[model samples]
Target: MRDHGIGHIVGTILDAPENASVVKELKEHAREAGFKAGYNECLSHVNPFYKSKFTDERSGFHGVDTKALYAAAVDTYNNLSISAIDDIEEFLEAENYVDRLRLLYDYPEEEETASGSKEDAGTSGTKED
Candidate 1:
């Protein structure tokens, strides 16, 4: 776990924050997915014969150990990106699974309003019943 990895981890967490129990869950999953490859590639370049990846085959880790990785990733994410995560979460909901297609048709707004003007957002008067 290093200070530098948090930004990438946080980006993964924010991508699907709803599924994540905590920021760490997201980080661990992301790291397990491809970060390990990238991490190992860099490490190998530094010491091609000696350095190993973050996970070792002797440990029998076919994939990320979610429980263990969660601890490390969360600790790193919290320490480095708690404030950034907080702000990001504030701007968007963790899980936003709206029925977009249904809503798009059900509540079809004027073209101008849909294009998003703040003034129009207040006066989208299609529902004037």
Candidate 2:
């Protein structure tokens, strides 16, 4: 899990300005370490913006359910990062294959769904109409 989180930090650093040499070096290091480095060019162009009030509201819920909430939040972030990494790897592999085929194509990606069971539905293990 720490490695996954570090991957996200490394990815962000790689996208930062004045880090081209560091990014190149990291790519080589990742290759040696048997880690696949993914490029996220869009992250470099877009700045993430969030409502401060909304963030505070969410933070206020911190100790509401303490352990359960912390577990859920960590699980969610780890899952999201893993999914993003998987999507990037798939895109890169597809791009390489398409380039070899000399065919023009575009990859459309979408968010992955959570692995929830019917029992996970709120209230009694039954669907509500």
Highest lDDT against the true fold, candidate: 1
For candidate 2, the 10 contiguous residues with the lowest summed lDDT are 34-43
Per-residue lDDT tens digits for candidate 2, residues 1-129, read 132333554565455443554445445444433321111233233435533312222333322444444455445434443433444456446535323222222222222347543321232312234
Per-residue lDDT of candidate 1, residues 6-121 (tens digit): 35445545564443456556565666655555655665677655655343443333555545665666566566544444544443342321222213223333243454563332
Per-residue lDDT value at 102 in model 2? 22
Q: Give the TM-score of candidate 1.
A: 0.23
> Quick one: best TM-score, which candidate?
2
Clashing pairs in 1: none
- Clash count, one per candidate: 0, 0
Candidate 2 residue runs with Cα over 4 Å from true position: 1-9, 13-63, 81-87, 95-129
Give candidate 1 misplaced runs (Cα > 4 Å).
1-24, 42-55, 59-126
Clashing pairs in 2: none
